[model samples]
Target chain A: MKYKDYYKILGVEKSASADDIKKAYRKLAHKYHPDVSKEADAEAQFKEVGEAYETLKNPEKRAAYDQLGSFQPGQDFRPPPDWGGQFGAGQHFSEDADFSDFLHGLMGGRFSQKHGGATMPIPGEDFEVAARITLEQAASGSEIEIKLSVHEPDAQGFPRRVPCSIKARIAKGATQGQRLRVPGKGGKGLNGGRDGDLYLKIELAPHRLYRVQDHDLYVDLPLAPWEAVLGATVEVPTLSGRVRLKVPPGTQAGQQLRLAHRGLPKPHKGEGDLYAIAQIVVPAKVSERESALYQQLAEGSDFKPRSHFDLEVADEH
Target chain B: MNIEISEAVWLDRAGVISMSELAQLSGLSEAILLQLIEYEVLPPAASAAGGPTFTGDCLVTARMACRLQSDFELDAAGLALVLSLLDRIRGLEAEVRGLQAQAPRRPHKA
Candidate 1:
């Protein structure tokens, strides 16, 4: 169907040595391996690199590919008329083989032969997908539905995409980035092999009021200036509900008030703690009478906030 | 569209799986899995009443080792070393994410 330049994909010359080709493939594989790589579209790049290396590593396949001559990548081109006679014919490739039609046409017969012409029990492929939930859901377990597109081989060994819908219950105390497994829920098995598993990676959606670290939750507790000065019982929001928290007299800004066992639940044992960070707020604008009262207080009070600045200046002098 | 409903199992919990189950899930043989266990790559979680058992996390690690070994032609020791390095990288990534969450956010402009 389309031409793909194996040498160009591998970043090697046509005349490059075998060792050079192998080295290039290794470097690219390490950089793009789906499990370890942080790059987007890493799985696609890895499949492309793997397909290119598969063809180039074998001398026979490489020779046949070289004889087909070069064309621009993705250019619509067909193999020569007698090409099928030189290589084995009547080999069909599935749409989801992850290999280009050109490589499949050139080497499909060898793949069949590599399997020894007998139907071997091939295990199903594992699938991984991300599942995003809320912090509240993580505290209390929730039910979720997930969809997956799996490739299943037909009677002719051509794989077709099969859409799967699974409903599962996420246990309580699930943390961010945790992986949950659904056994035998992945791609179907071939030749009586067992079905593969489905892995769901838990991702907690950002909460409007809370930030999570491990199981601990942190929330900002905004207080008025007078409320910070005098003791008050303020209502604080938690995952379960709201609770009244006592603000001691003269509570400082940025102080953390810990609410024991108010955070997310642990898997087996105790629950995590929640911290309410204090933030003192003042009125943006004041009336004339209030301003006069403030002026009187400012003159009456002897508190100097910039005392450290004068001390630092004197030390420098 | 095939709709299949099922329950999920958390790997980090105390639920343990047998060695044969691990081999079947990972697509590796029992002998090779034993060699990996000897290298401390796939450590058994505990010795259950029946026999030695592994946690569900071992299934993921074993599958990764199978793929890496086949793709790179690595030995048991080499696969173990790579797996350890990958674990370190994952730990660092989680730590970074935690720090980013704790960092104070800048005020939004109106």
Candidate 2:
């Protein structure tokens, strides 16, 4: 699998202000809205753009993505074995509408709440629902089928998706609380009025993979003390998958390794990134040989580990 | 098992009608609009300064006209007359709404 960049899809710079990113997405959404668009791929492109905007617009998810690298769209993406730690029984996004397998493979299958058209239009009859998908889908894009008891406009010229299925292409880089509109799939009209569309409220689920912060992805990359101390090529996990990481020599714990174009793929153009924080783990106790080695290291090195420490004088003047 | 498939005209995203400012999107064509004007059914595109230039509200008008032409078998002249009547009726309805609002508010099925 490959990670996709959310920023590129929305057409913004890595350091683009939040406001700029949002503006870009809104412009694209309006342009690609299926109801008005006549292009062959308008609906798909609109959804893709929306998803990309969703990811980059959020500060938390964006940050988590930044850890992997500069996100690219459609690049081979795969998360490491320990990507999400454990994808247990928990639904994050709603995929009430039908989505694509590409999205499923990329996102790891998140489902969203499906909604339908409004009826009983004396007034105030509105329909609303939600969808839950994984962070992967937000980054890589997917297709989903939202099954709702909708009234599709038939040849007779009435409202219709009734008992209809709307196929939604969940864009890569979609963020939590993002709302997408499935035109003509909204609430029923009043007195033969136009049907209100389906509004999708996006919600993200928590995973053990990494903590998201804006466009950067942060994951605790476990490293042996020796590996951290001596530069080594470590197999680090990203949202896309695992890649050989270069740990600089004498690397300290909590140091982050940045790999470009390795984060969430963008819907269209820009990329999000990922970060790997080197976390060193040690056993509670070491064998005698290990202890002797440490002792030798202590004897040979004059470097004071706590030299920066300051102690209060016994008698303060 | 082998299967038989049929082909049909697929209209998906529609198309883009880029204007100097906002793009007018639609699946219909300019010829349709010309026919509409020739019949004198609806108003022409008025590009008020700092407003949508080419065709803004024309999308809805065009859709209605297209539906009338394709489904009702209404020729361009017939559509123009019918749509003109419909627009007049709509105006009357709006005036009625205004008058009703002055009288009282009631929960009525439109």
Candidate 3:
């Protein structure tokens, strides 16, 4: 196994006091905490720091580790033959099996047990991964196949990921960042311990025609210039199916028309409402006859555009 | 490599874990768990004859509490206070996410 330099991991000297070690560990723990840190490898770094602290915090373990003398980190080295026997004199170390194989070899079997001759029970570490799904899948519950990296022990008891896939059921209306738990699918257990859980955080993919707001769904309902001026029946697409919507007379752009109980499904309550937003569009190129008709209508109409702007200018003057 | 799919139980969604199961899963001793319960660090989902029954979330809390207590040597009351604050922080974060999701979307560029 590769040798680990606990002092370097903790940023402490070999002659550093336990109090100094504790302070250094505290600083690193806060800096690399998974919940608060933004660093890319914060979780891994935090585990390494924890492992280093676990060994150095105890005087017996520290003394025993110091006896091996200085060796570069990642250098292949083996512990003394009777190194594991020394664990009987050290403090009880109850932690997850996140330490490196070097530390494991140093402590040996004695560190793997607890109490009066009973094996220590250390549950596996939990794993979390984000899974992206489409809006249709969110609207109608679907089964999704996802990959998870599960840890398994080698012949020497070192942890390594064995890529595995499982079909997960995503319930309808699964919100963004909602956790779907699949228990006993995490890192491997130690000493015949139970496995940890796997949590899948839901991420909804962006839709071309729809935007989600909680359970409410929003879609831009495009209309022609003439249609916006005069009311017309329009077909709107919803999650379930297409439905005819009545466009009120003098419908303005950027207006939202609500369709009740047509949005995403709720686990406990009725479905939310869907809003169809109005968007007016004009043809880019017009024929000569169409241009002439538009010119005639513009000349005949007495509608003054931005009349309120004139009033505002008068008020300012 | 030979790939395999493992069966998984929904810890937070489906199962109601007993005290012993929680203790084993969280790697916490019964005595420490009792102290934590007394201090309200870990709350149970249901009460029973053996003890308070917990779900997966409680098991998570227990693990966190145990690790923090070991590292910082925090008393039961202090751990409970910290845990309560952490819970409040998590709730606020979820609330923020909900509000952001409900915000109006910008129109797509033509």
Candidate 4:
């Protein structure tokens, strides 16, 4: 097992007073708390700090840890041969104790008793995983299989992470950032305690054809310049399927053509709208006859796109 | 490989869980949960036939409160203050995410 320097973890001196140790722990805990901290590994850092404080805060555990002598963190070492004999050797640690093997060897049965009596019922630890699904899956419910590495104790009562697989059905109308609770799927409870729950945070993967804003869906509807000037019926894609939409004459660029009740499904309500934003596309290449026709139209028509610019310049002057 | 079909509930739905269920799921005592409710750290979504019911988000908050209470030996009032601050931070983070999503994406300069 690797040696861990508890004092170094808490950033306190080996001879620091209990109050100083506590103050250090509080500061670190505040900085590294998973919910509060934005650090990428805040949860892991918080657990390490908590484990260090768990041992150092107690008088007996600290004394016992001190007797083992200091070593470099992560240096491979085992407890002294007589170490178990000195501490409570015959006592068994709790199956749910998640402390490091080093602390488990040093503290013995004292830690288990402090948490709750060995026979006392302790609930299992909850697990959370962020699951990403496609927009179609959110529109229509889908089944997903999730593999989780759950921390469990071996037959000898040593902590180990065992791989667990679970299959869950995400209900339809589930929105992005929704939390789905799977009961009795988390860590196993101890001493007849209730099993913990698993929380799956639903994330919608970006779609190639659509952009989602809440339940609304947006898609770029490319139209020919003539089609924008003349009315036409165009086929639009919805989550369910394709539908024919009427594009009115004189449709401008960036205009949203709303198709009601065609977007994502909302729980306990009607579906959201699908908006097709108009984009007029001009032909990049044309035949000689088409170029001549365009030139004739350009000379015949007195359309001025820069009229707004001229007006703004005149106003400024 | 064998597949185990699990029972799941959406947390955002109103009145999904009771106070007792929340207490059990959070590994906190009912009395402690009551104290948190009294301090408004966890406000129930609605009152059910049996008692007040909470949304799924309360479970996360309740678990956090349990840990903070044990780790820092904080009272209900202190936990309330900390929880309120955490809620504000989450709100600000969500607002920032929304704003970023609305902002136009610009190509990075090499």
Candidate 5:
């Protein structure tokens, strides 16, 4: 096994006082705490620091570890062959601390205890994973499956993997970033303790046709120029199905029309409204007859499209 | 392959859980949890004749406090401050997201 210099990990000297060690550990732990730190590997770094402090904080463990003299971090080293039976079965570190094999070897298998008689209870650590779903799935309830790699302690305290697949129910109107908790589905507890719960974070995949803002859904509604000028009833697509929406007379581009109760489902309430924004489209190509009709209308009409530009210039001047 | 259907109970959906269940799920002692509640690190949602009840969101908060206590040796006051600050940050982030969602589309840069 590679030697791990606990003093080096804590950035302290081997002869440093216990107070100095404690101060350094506190500073590093606070800096690297996963919830507070924005570092990508803050969690891993925090665990490493915790492991280092676990050994250095205790005098007995420190003395035992210091016996392997002058060994550097990452150097090949092994504990003395006669060192296996000295430690007792009592656990010192926290339940979530999955100590390295080096520490386990030093303690003659730390998790190994006398299971034939009464055993100490240690609850397993909770685990989390994201479950991604489509927008339609978020609107309507669906079932999802996720795989978790659980660590099971053997009869001798050696760790082994047990792959578990869980099928979960997603309730209707579940929004992005919502967490669904599953009870007693995490890592196995030690000595018959209860298993930890699993937290599934919901992630809504982006949709091409719609944009979601909370429960409200937005879609671009393209219409012909004549249809925008004259009132028309048009069909719009919603999560549930298609519904006919009325376009009021003289509807302008960029104007949004609300279709009540046609958006995503809300918890303990009716569905939210969908906003369909108007986009007027003009024909790029015209036949001779259509061109003549358009020319006649353009000559006969008194409408001025640039009337707003004159007002804007006068305001600026 | 056999498909195992999990009889999952969504904590957020349930909204409230008993104190004993919270303790069991968070792996914290009842006394320490009571201390946390007393310090306002986590507030209970309701109270019964037996004991106080907490929201499912408190499960995450209690578990986090437990870990921070173990890793950094923080006291109840420290846990309370940290948890409150974290909650504020989450609120701000959600507000920012809502505002962004409401904003109109910007013109494409040339």
Candidate 6:
């Protein structure tokens, strides 16, 4: 594991007070929070800062950590003598961070268990936020704004809305219900606790052309009776917009035509499929001539919508 | 590499869920979550000390199960299959995100 410099992470002096450490953490936290930052390592660095703040903000932990002497960035390190004695010697340390092995060895395991429910403890327990995007956004991926309530102003001020701009990545098959985590935009940690994370659950609005089911995209292609009875090339809508599709003769309603690898495309996995379901459209209000033509057709072949069921019932008897 | 380092980790994930949290999070009665478990549509959560505890995955699975039951009126088995398929699809998406992130980001032309 990489050695963490708590003081440096918190941006404070070695002799800084707990209050000073906390103040520094809050400032850095607001800046590097993944929901707000576009920096490459912002999320990972935020977690690191949060872990640092968690260790240093408490007096007992800080005192013990200080006793261990300075942590040289590239040097071999070890815990101070009698590390557990510092814990609970006075106040209960808040659950400000999820500490690391080094801290746990130095501060003890009590930090993890006792600190629970101290950070960002809300009645809802979890906050769920979703974003609705167009098909285009999902196809090309997008950077979008999702507003999250990071804080409710105290008696001293107005309630403020923390606008979080996140670069949303469209999953190869991210149809809907796909979620991404933006660290540190959630409810504020309690008693000077580390802030919870912000979740971006995606919901794609229904498209006019394609209906997505998992990795598959579905489209209903309307065909004339002749097209259904005799195969022909017809225009259809896809995620890529209009494309021509072949309609086989004697195609039935609910009969699906598969387009391999024409749907959702994954990174490593093979692409998903597009299914075109055939629907035979007959004019509800036909002209006299059209009605006469239909009448002539009706006089021709025998078709039963529920033939199988009739056979089963008669066989049972 | 997908180490579940914390509880809040599941707050964002759909299928990952805790046992007691499953019903409460989805605004569904306990009976409902239990029914999902009974039907085997929803995978039962992990247990500690003989008591049932769930992982983060259950939350999304339960929410999806509820939506399926309500929206499309699908039965338990159908909901399970659909949710499983959805989870697999999500897995594919995560893979794509990883590739995109690594896809040689270029500095714009000056």
lDDT of each: 0.78, 0.54, 0.71, 0.78, 0.75, 0.59
lDDT of 4 by residue, A1-317 (tens): 67789999999999999999999999998899876788889988998998899898999889878877878997766555565445544434444343375365446532333233477766787888888899999898889889987766555554555678999998777767777789888877777877888888888998877777667777778888778989789999899899999999999877889999998897556787888888787777888998999899899989887899999999999
lDDT of 1 at A287: 92
Clashing pairs in 1: none
Off by over 4 Å in 6: A1-127, A152-172, A187-195, A300-317, B1-110
Q: Write the per-residue lDDT of candidate 5 for residues A245-309, one digit (tens) a residue.
A: 99999998878899998888875568887888787776767789989988998999999999999
**Ten-residue region with minimum lDDT total, candidate 2 chain B:** B4-13
Q: Which CAPRI quality tier does the interface of model 6 achieve? A: incorrect
lDDT of 2 by residue, B1-108 (tens): 322221111111222222331211222455656666667653445536543234334444555565456434457777788678767876776566434322312212
- The better-scoring model by TM-score among 2 and 6 is 6
Question: Regarding TM-score, does 3 or 6 come out ahead?
Answer: 3
Please list the residue runs of candidate 5 whose C-alpha ends up more than 4 Å from where it truly belongs after superposition: A1-32, A62-85, A88-110, A114-118, A220-235, A247-256, A267-270, A277-317, B35-41, B105-110
Chain A superposition TM-score, candidate 5? 0.69
**lDDT comparing candidate 4 with the true structure:** 0.78
List per-candidate RMSD values in Å: 3.9, 27.0, 6.1, 4.5, 5.5, 19.4
lDDT ranking of the models: 4, 1, 5, 3, 6, 2
What TM-score does model 5 achieve against the real structure? 0.74
Backbone clashes in model 6:
13
* Interface RMSD, per-candidate values to 1 decimal: 3.2, 22.7, 4.6, 5.4, 4.8, 18.5
Backbone clash total, candidate 2: 115
TM-score of each: 0.82, 0.42, 0.68, 0.80, 0.74, 0.44
Q: Which ten residues in a row have the lowest lDDT in candidate 5 chain A?
A: A90-99
Candidate 6 residue-wise lDDT, A1-317, digit = tens: 23467888787889887779778877886567654455888777887877777678677777776776776654554444454445533322223222264365335432233343234333322345677887667665555665453433322222223444334344444556655555555555444555555556778787766766555667666667788888899887776767778887789766888887777654335666888777777655778998898888889869777899999999999
Better of 2 and 4 by DockQ: 4
Query: Tens digits of per-residue lDDT for model 2 on A199-254?
Result: 46566666566555434456667667778778889787778678998888888776
For candidate 4, give the lDDT of residue A305: 77
Which tens-of-lDDT digit does each residue in A143-241 have in candidate 1? Answer: 888877665544554444567788878889888877789888877765666777888889999999888888888887778766887879999999989
